[model samples]
Target: MISPTLIQAKGLRKGYGQRTVVDGLNLDIREGEVLAIIGPNGAGKSTTLDLLLGLRRPDAGTITYWTTDPSPHVGLQLQSTPFFAGFTAIENLRMFAAFYGKRLKDAQLMEHLHRCGLEEFAKTDALRLSGGQQKRLAIAMTLVHSPKLLFLDEPTAALDPRARRDIRELIRSLADKGTSIVFTSHDMEEVHKLASRLVLIRDGRIIASGSPEELLSQYGTASLEQLYIQLTDEPA
Candidate 1:
């Protein structure tokens, strides 16, 4: 059976004065799937994410959500998550829970912490946690309200191999339980492991998009990295 479309964006165009970041883009985010947007530094991946999450309004386009109240159903985890330095991991979760009007019991909060593999550091100060732990805490904060749609920008960026694997597993678990995710990452391996579908953007336009196998076959490339290079590499 075909999954329902959770979000539909048509002709999404955004720019800063003369430079267009996202240009005439069209995309559909389906229910209960991981869609990864991959691109180089200035490819407007972040801008596209911001626009989709309603953080920035598109200059020209229509974004439609299937749900009547989409705002409450969405969650966002940015590249640099902001946390109170003095707050413990649990405290941070509690504070964000309050922001979402959620009142989580200590046990419930601990369950989330354990799920993120941060149970041991539940009482640790947010600033003291390792990079991986901090990222997990950020994810816990985002999932506190149990949002149906998650927007993650670089969820596994700058982490060691084990940390990246853990985060990837956590994401896969969430998807297994029916959470729809749209994320951006430069790690082609991470993208290969997590993304059910992939979209490649360059200089504000979607250059290529498809499932990993589909794209590889279409481009006749050995891997996503080679395909990406082939698609985005400038001629000498």
Candidate 2:
């Protein structure tokens, strides 16, 4: 069964010094759904994410969350790793949980580490881990509080094929376990593989949105890449 709407955004708008980044956008983030927001470099995808994550305030809009306070129920993983200097992997997870006002047992922390494949590196400095390991650790930190909603920005942007596949599988696992995920990605294949629904934006506005297969059939395109280009490319 489809879950209820976890987040509702209406008439979202944001601007910077006479230039608008997010222009009158609206979105619904449903429970247990994997929603992918995709667009070109300057399409304001990141800005929209920031607005929804409450990292940045929208110039005009209303975002309603299921809970009174959404922070405790939401998790976020940015593209860059934000590990504390000199902190081990497990320590960082503990720190993050503490930030959320929750103290987890050692076994619980270890379970998170094991889930992210970082148990072996529990004592290792997070910064000393490889790029992929750091990303995995970042994800583990996000899950420390066991949030109901997750926002991931380019989770697998710069990783090896194996690491990318690992992260993809992890996302699939999370969605299968009834975690609502909202993520942004430039990789069309990854978006196609993981996104239950796709929101294609241009210049801060949604040009198209629907299930990947639905969009493909609507546009009569072979793949998400072709549809993306057709809708986002500049007119000659």
Candidate 3:
């Protein structure tokens, strides 16, 4: 096994200036588990992700991965960014894959392209691909190394329905293989569909964290979306 849990963050805190984004947060993402973070606008979801990914230093607290070998372990699919816009999709993967110090053959790269349903676009320049395609390419890069701990930010934000389904399936398959995931999304349905555990963030704090069913029953709400508004907006 890849261990019981892959990531544990305690009292995690991060912020800019006076605005504390992620405040005294605590999280435990286990191996082979899909944990999703759902929250309303400006809830510091991205900030929390940044802290976990080591993209930024926490204002207070610590994040440690549970593993025998700890070598700055984590992969992040940025919330929104054009990856290798000037290069072809395959070419971009070729470039990013090198950083992992693992050699994924050309055939393997093609498989990821195919998985993204972008096999036809393999030769297409990333800049030429549509917004959704670009996002898929970024996600493909993150998986190239098969990193055990992954932090995905709004991965399917602009994807069409079919693309969304494919990405969700891909994530599930990875988790099945013992990969841990921390996904952030504004799409309530997507979070519920893929997240084994859900953590709701509001204004830089985790307002609630539990299983999807637990959240529904706890709030007596019909759906996660409804619960989201109730928790964050407090229902005027």
**lDDT scores of the candidates, listed in order:** 0.92, 0.91, 0.84
Error of 3 at 73 (Å): 5.0
Clashing residue pairs for model 1: none
Mark the regions of model 1 whose C-alpha exceeds 4 Å error after superposition. Answer: 234-236
For all predictions, the C-alpha RMSD in Å is: 1.5, 1.6, 2.3
Ranking of candidates on TM-score, top first: 1, 2, 3
Candidate 3: misplaced stretches above 4 Å? 1-3, 68-73
lDDT of 1 by residue, 54-131 (tens): 889999999998987898889899988999879899999999999989999999999999888899999999999988
Could you say which candidate leads in TM-score?
A: 1
lDDT of 2 by residue, 85-127 (tens): 8999999999989999989998999999888777899999989
- The sequence of per-residue lDDT tens digits that candidate 3 reaches over residues 73-156 is 666799776576678999998888887786778899999899878889999988889999989988988888778788899988
In model 2, which regions exceed 4 Å deviation?
234-236
lDDT minimum window of 10 residues, candidate 1: 227-236
Cα lDDT for residue 146, candidate 1: 95
Q: By TM-score, is 2 or 3 better?
A: 2
What's each prediction's TM-score? Answer: 0.95, 0.94, 0.92
Model 3 RMSD, rounded to 1 decimal = 2.3
Candidate that beats the other on lDDT, 1 or 3, i.e. the better one: 1
